[model samples]
Target chain A: MKKILRTHILLFLLFALLLPSCMNEPVMPPNTNEGNFEALWKIIDTRYCYLDYKNINWDSIHDVYKTRLATDTTEFEFFDLLGDMLAELKDGHVNLSSNFDRSRYWNWYTDYPSNFSGSLISSSRYLGKDYRVAGGFMYQKIANDSIGYIYYGSFSDGFSDTNMWYIMNYFIDCKGLIIDVRDNGGGSLESAEALASYFFKNDTVTGYIRHKIGDGHSDFSSPQEIVTKANKKIQWQRPLIVLSNRLSYSATNDFINRIKASPNALVIGDQTGGGGGLPFSSELPNGWSIRFSASPMFDRDMQHTEWGIQPDIIDSLKVADVERGYDTIIEKAIKIINQSN
Target chain B: MKKAGFLILIIFFNVSVYSQTRNADTYLLSNVANTFGFGAISVLDPYLSPLQYNGIGLKYDNDNLRFLDTEKLNLSRQSKFTITAAEALNPAFTSLMMLVGANYQYGMYYHFQPISDLKVLAGGSCDVDFAVKYLPRNTNNPVNMDMSTNLNISAMAFYKLKLLKRDVQLQLSLQSPLLGCMFVPQTGASYYELFLLGNLTDAFHFSSLHNKRGFQSRLLLHVPFKRSNWHVGFDFNMLKYSANGAVYKKDDFGLVVGTTFDMISFSGRKNLPPSNFKSITE
Candidate 1:
């Protein structure tokens, strides 16, 4: 009996020691010559922590790639296959690099650079105090003729009531204002509100927030803060012209959408960046993080701003206009504003 | 009977002498080389109640322990050192261990441009020699290289507690090496300094100083295997990063579950208890 007990103890100890080694998975060197497509697939299979591809049809993407790999001979074909796959993901983080002529694609795609020589201003140093040459937050001085001009680079940050106070104070006396959110990639809605509030004096209907529920959707209007103090200083009544381009996005798009609904506002320039939603972050298993849109947004009139916001005046710029040093969009806006006056 | 007693006495004496000679504890306390390699005497001391093997028993000396003394002992140590010091004063007092580790890492800094737009916008800008351009009519271009070496020294300390006996460990680590400079060309300057220190093992082993970018803080919850020296855990980190002067600061968190194997062990000669076997036999 004693001998049996001792044998059992020894066996248990041996098993305990060997079990850990047996459980550990063997580490193998990665196959480098598996081709780019195979390598990418393997990486996603092994490294990607997320099980769900956000309801995206990954199998279809794989099937397309497999079909391409079977028959496609050209390198450009492979590149297009990868590009189409990435586009299906709809994730900004996922991208592929290929050796291809970029200038060919550049020539095919239309570029819109809004040519408006103007200064930018903010009420507080938080937004920016200095009047930069172009595409930076700057303060605008409203002239006695009730005309206001403000140039902004991007509207992604530094937008607050305090920061917008300077522009508001300047435009208090002006009848009309030119808000150049042309190249603004979009920022916070609070800054947009500061700009939007100037047009909509009544706090009753500001904007709306759209969110995704479990099965359906939901929408909520922004709360109103009554402006008790009357403008004893400067007061003007004229139409406002908001300058924009394809780069204008997020809060910038929201601003355009809201102002377009108003009776006294006009949107001028090309389409916007087509980003109109609240952003959210998600964690993947492979320790890679992704920030994406969580919910789709809409204006007061239940209009979605997803496929780029259309402007009132489709004042698109051309290369010929650039060569001639003519800002046709701004000139047209100025002309319209003058004609209205 | 007499012969057996004498044999026992001799065996005990020999074993004691051998054990004394093989004592790692003495070397750990007195040797300067061991101190530099591992750490000070306080760190080397055993924490848990030592288990008895055969006739010999090993026990931790807890009477002379002090925080300041441990800190002083660790002053001279440098490079790749792990100190796990725990304190539990009373029954009501919660047990806590402060774990700190440091390691020297060497790796390359890679700048990945996702799109070609960034490259065209950044690379097209050229530099002209102001002195020659304004005065002389010669066109001389200066050599320019965009890559640079980033040397960083990072140190972090965390307080860990065993939530359940060997099952879970909850830790909150303070971010460190918070300040470091990257040497890059003036034109291609971007703040890519965000680092998320994951696990204690990962922080010590795989973490590189140059790759410490795109995450400001991290929180880790380790789920350890019961009765096994292996753990598979999850991690979440917050990242604040920017590119092309566009700040994209968000709660960039991630989850990683990996297993760790503890392979380190201490080996030493056996110690024998004192005995008067010779006299008793006689």
Candidate 2:
């Protein structure tokens, strides 16, 4: 009887010992100069959301960059080469953050007109000294209280539902509300969604979001619906004009996408600098950080917006208007509001 | 597959015990333990942050031992659970990153006495690991997830001696992961693709010594009073797992303190005196 117990115990131990042999092949990429280069290339190749849409020849890009790699290449030089490789994707969300510098692509706004002039706004007394601050938004009555103007500079700053209630209530008497998001580089999605929800009375299916699921570049999961529910707070039912420019990006772009469906809303300004993908970060073998768009966000029509989103009514900044201390884009929106009233 | 493996192990043990000679005397022993630990952890995901963190943890352990032969062999099982919170920094130590983790393990052992004062045991165990690391200020890729399951080989030793004319028990044990499966995104894959999209292909990785290995060691001491005994011990644990160009490691050392109880014992013969096993309180 004791011998049987011993035999069973031995067999159990043997089974335990044999399990290790079944492990799958390792997927660890090497850590070298060429290794780091190949690693970055492969990551972007598989995970970056806009490769096919943007029509980038990733393999050709790899061939061009591989010649620059050497065993003795300096870390700084290697970083430059990697930065250049990433720039080919022409995405602002893609960056390489390091102790010395953070690489970026800004042609989304740089090559276009600077449709916003901050100095002119300050001098025009449009946002007077008494302009109230509601989270990231600064607001006041403009054109002699004929129209309500709210300039949202960024989405990073958070505001409570109470703050939104106060801002919309203060503008309740105005002919129309102008949401000026010029040069508003994006921040939090939650903040953007919260503000956008105020314009809708029902649950709105704003867009679709999907991410890479496998190692293959074309591998992706089914698109998930991105719904923006109506705000539980005070809703804004007045005529809404959303002012945008080349610098209105990321979540700001998402905000415009949300408000576009509103019948009372009109998007007027230069084309918006679009960043329609959610960015995720990674690291290289050398410990340098890499940030790239991992998930693709689409418009209601399921069209890609990585390049830029077209304005319903395109309006470029006039130097003449700036010199006269008037924002031409704001003037156009105010005229449209007054004409409608 | 994991459930099936667990059931097979249980059946194997039950059959082994049933086949053993029915000793006239048998005893059941159990103990509960609490441990507090401090440890350093490093996580390297080429697609996430490449920094290490340090943090504190709390652990709880429960052990049940049944002796079939007072001096020869016994069956034992241990369940341990732990939770940890840690942070990571850059070379300057100014930038901070954070992680919170939890682990639970269960081991079944068969003990045999090789010498008069020493008892050795061999066994197997299963463990589950879960963790989430958050970078306080990272905009896009701010959170990383770590989770896995492991089947391990475990061993233990016990010794009894007299200290200052009082009987004392000393015990040590080690458990090493031999085979397992874990969730690993390909070098650049995102959780959205794998979890939300159900891209499970290559998500469940087969892990072994080549890609994952680790050991946990525990040393415990038991002191007797008039009734139950006082238990105090130290524990050291280390684990390293690397796959898909990512590496994760954990090192922890802790102090344990608890108490022991003799829950139940049934003898085939009548009126058995209290157990004579010196490796644990009788």
Candidate 3:
């Protein structure tokens, strides 16, 4: 009996010792200029959500960038090279971070018309000193107190349901409400969803989002439905006008995509600068952090929103009008609201 | 196929113990030990980040060992409980992963005195374990949870000797899981889908010796002083698993200190001891 136990125990130990040999782990490249370059390139090639969707020739870009890499390249020069490679994707949401600088691609907004004039919005003709601020929204009556205009510049700021209740009461008598999201470079998606909830009349299918499921470029999970439910107590049943420009991006783009479905909503002004992809963070072997788009979002029609979304009514701001103390886009929005009312 | 073969071998080794005679009616004493450990730990949770993190680990353990009610004192039962926590940072010093885990085990072991100073115990155990790894960096997937129940095999050795006219005891114990079921979500699955959208699909997985491997070994030295025994030991643990093309790992090596004591009680499951067995709690 004892011999049997001994033999079993010996055999068990032998099996336990052999189990580790089965471990299969990817071999991480050594930390060098070439190694960091490969790591950064692979992270984008495998995980970035918009590569195939945007029709980017990533392999060609990689070939062009590889020739610029030198063994003695300084860290700063290496960062610049990688930043240039990322720019080929033409995405504002992609960035590379180091102690010295953060690299970004601004052509999404920079190459377009600046349809918004900050100085004009703050003038007495519009949201002057009387404009009250609540929940990151700057509000006052415009068009001779006939219309309500609110300038919300960022989604990073948070507000509560109580704030929405009070804001609704303030706009109760206006002909319509204008939400100007120009020059807003996106912050939190939840904030965007919350603000959109007030405009939705009922539970609505706003859009869809897909997450990367594997390392392959086209590998993604089934599109999950993004539903925007109405805020029962603070519903905005009045005519809603959402303003956009070349700089309206990221979460702002998402908000525009959702609120556009409202029965009483009209999107006006320039096409929104689009950054519809949600970014996730990663790092290279050299310890520099890489932020890339890891999830893709779509509109109700399953249309890709990576490029700017078209306004139902297109309007552009001419510097000649700003100089003449007349905000033409606001004038057009007021004209439309008055006609609708 | 390879995993199924190893699982059958483990089950065969454990099932042979019940083939012995069913005449187990002898009352016996139980020894209980409580230990606390603290040491350095390293973690690599690829779902959280590509970088590895290093930090300190803390664990607490309670063990109860007692011979079963048998005619001969050759079979013993053991119950153990352990809890561990660790917080670590990525190599870039930009991210942090906080982890907490707990486990409980119960098993029966066979004792064999191969030599005058050497006693070896081998057995199989059934255990349940749960753990959570939290990384605040990810926007959509912030936390990953692990829950599993396992069948395990364990072995222990005890050597008693004299040095400098003093009697001392040395012990080595090892345990590993052979098969179980585990929760392994997709590599980058969104928590928003699982929690907010309430879509829970393809998260639970059947784990075997091939995909999941773990082992723990503890060595202790007991010193007799003032008619009581106090022990200091080192514990080493390693665990690695894969599912949905993602691999996760956790490793710990720590030092522990504890004391041993004997206990006896008149319970429904335990037989009443005769005059030969002493009960301190009686």
TM-scores of all models?
0.38, 0.76, 0.84
lDDT (Cα, tens digit) per residue for candidate 1, span A1-341 = 44663474356335433322322221222322124455455333322222132454555667777766744356566556555654554433233432232111111013545434332123221123544333235545434345666776665555544455555565666656777787676775555655566565444343444322221112222221212122233222478888888767767886787677556789998877655545432212211222334344565555556556888888876557645655567556667887886
C-alpha lDDT score of every prediction, in listed order: 0.38, 0.74, 0.82
Candidate 1 chain A: worst-modelled 10 consecutive residues by lDDT: A101-110
* Candidate of highest TM-score: 3
> What is the alpha-carbon lDDT for the whole of candidate 1?
0.38
- Report the lDDT tens digits of candidate 3 across residue range A1-341: 56775697678666665665467765555678888789889889988999898899889888999999998888899899999999888999889887788899999888888989999999998999889989889989998888999899999988889887888788889989999999998888888999999988798998898878888889988888889888888888888899999899999999999989888899999999998888877777666777788888899998888887899999998778899887778888899999997
In terms of DockQ, which candidate is stronger, 2 or 3? 3
Q: Give candidate 3 misplaced runs (Cα > 4 Å).
A: A1-7, A124-126, A130-133, A141-146, A324-327, B1-33, B62-81, B89-97, B103-130, B134-143, B155-169, B224-229, B259-282
Which of 2 and 3 is the better model by lDDT?
A: 3
By DockQ, the best candidate is 3
- Candidate number that wins on DockQ, 1 or 2: 2
Candidate 1's displacement at residue B63, Å, is: 25
| Residue-level lDDT tens digits of model 2 in A4-88 | 6458546644554343334433254566788778878877887787888888999999999898787788878878888999999
RMSD of each: 23.8, 7.5, 5.3
